[model samples]
Target: MARVSQEHLDARRRQILDGAAVCFARNGFHATSMQDVLKEVDLSAGAVYRYFSGKDALIAAIVGEVLDQVHEGFEEGARSTPPPPPDALLASVLSRVLATKESVTVDGRPAFPRLIVQVWTETLRNDELAAVLREGYGVVQRTWARIVEAYQDAGMMRPDVTPDHVARTMMASAMGFLAQQALFGPAPVEVLRDGLRGLMSVPDRGAGSQSG
Candidate 1:
């Protein structure tokens, strides 16, 4: 048998994941069995199993991919700049995130949003998934919290605002926006940028700045 090339393998894996994402979006994870995934991809059992052992594995990959995409967007922007102004900093990262999630997947569905929400909903009933989901969020929360603190240190953000509070609030807002987009399709990037601009607004803290 001719050896499978790395590009082909990666493409195949992505194809399976994309199909699984669509199936999960259309039918609840529990309701959609491996057979459903098989149908989604139009692949034989052997071919499907080659990529994912079962639904749990597929769901894990889906959630993992979503988390990685969001994390990459933040890490990329944060690492490339020297703690840029909070407004510019956030604009860069948030725009990357909006673009990343809105990009089309191999299956022609939006890369994220609805698919992520579906897996999130499944976590309510799935202990394993919930654990993974929590872990993923914890990492994101900490990373963003540090960014919040950095902004404070730079005098660009209000020092009185707890880092965790700001970070969590931003995260919650992003999640809410994602849920909305998932249900109703893509939202204008301007609305998101405007929201972030408001959230990250840094009041002038010149000489004798008041914290009240």
Candidate 2:
């Protein structure tokens, strides 16, 4: 038998992952069986199992892949000259996320956001998945903290608040937006940008009083 090229093997693995993502997104994790994934990819059980041990393994890989993208986006921004302001940085990431999810949507509903929400719920019972998520998000958060520190140094953000705290809060806001988008229909990305701008515009009462 001719040896399978590494490129071909990688492509097959990607196919399995993409198919599993769609199935899990269309139907909840519990509802999507391994057979459903095999059917979606039109691959035999042996072929699919060779890539992922089972549904849980697929779920973990899918979630890790998505989170890794998000982490990379933040890392990229940090490398830019004067890195994007917080709002623009976040808006860019959100736009990419929406577009990617929209590409694999089912019945006009984006699969990626839905799958994200499902993963959050799944983490409640699955300690292993929860650990994976925590570590992934933790790295993203650290990157954001570094960005926050830069903002503080440039006087764009207040220096009083801890960078980690600001980063975590920003992450929470972003997650809330995703949950809202998933539960309801899609909203313009402007909504998120405007909201962040409005928050940034708010005066710091402590600073105002001390300066008076």
Candidate 3:
């Protein structure tokens, strides 16, 4: 048999991942069967197994892809010239996330939010998946932390707040907002902006205050 080229292999893998993402999102990790995935990709069981050993492996890949997309969004936000101000950086990150929500569709359905929830729940029950999810979330938190630290160092943030604290708070707020929007409907961007500003804001410490 003629050997399949690397390019062909990668393309096939991407197709499988895309199909698996849609299935996992709609039926969820626990509810979804290998056959459901097979139906999505129109591939044989053996063909699907070639890319992913089983449902767990496929779910892991789908979650990893979602994390990668989020990372890309942050990278795009960071690349803005002169870098965005603290407020702009937060907004930019949120905007990128929203943009991804709008753009990523599968089988005439929006799957990202569902996929995210599935990954979160599954992570609690599965150690390997939990580790991957934790690592991915850590990367996101670190990215925001670095941005917060830069602003703090530059005197843009109130000196009383630590970068790690601000970063964690901001991420928590963003995740909550995302959950609300996914469960309800789209929220006003201004509401998110205000919430983030409030979390990152520092009260003015008078010049006479001792510099810790």
Per-candidate count of clashing residue pairs (backbone under 3 Å): 0, 0, 0
Taking the tens digit of each residue's C-alpha lDDT, what string does model 1 give over 7-85? 9989888888878877777666778888888887898999989888899999998788777877766665455434665
Which candidate should be chosen as best, given TM-score against the real structure? 2
Q: How far is candidate 1 from the true structure (C-alpha RMSD, Å)?
A: 3.6
Query: Worst lDDT window (10 residues) for model 3?
Result: 77-86
lDDT of 2: 0.86
Candidate 3's residue-wise lDDT over 17-132, tens digit each?
87777778777788889898899889999988988999888877877876787677666655553356655565666776666555445555566666667777787899999999
Worst 10 residues of 2 by lDDT: 203-212
Query: What's the true lDDT of residue 16 in model 3?
Result: 87
Per-model CA lDDT versus the true structure: 0.74, 0.86, 0.73
lDDT of 3: 0.73
Winning candidate number (lDDT): 2
* TM-score per candidate: 0.83, 0.91, 0.77
Per-residue CA lDDT of model 2 for 83-148, tens digit only, reads 788888998887876776566766767777777888999999999999999999999999999998
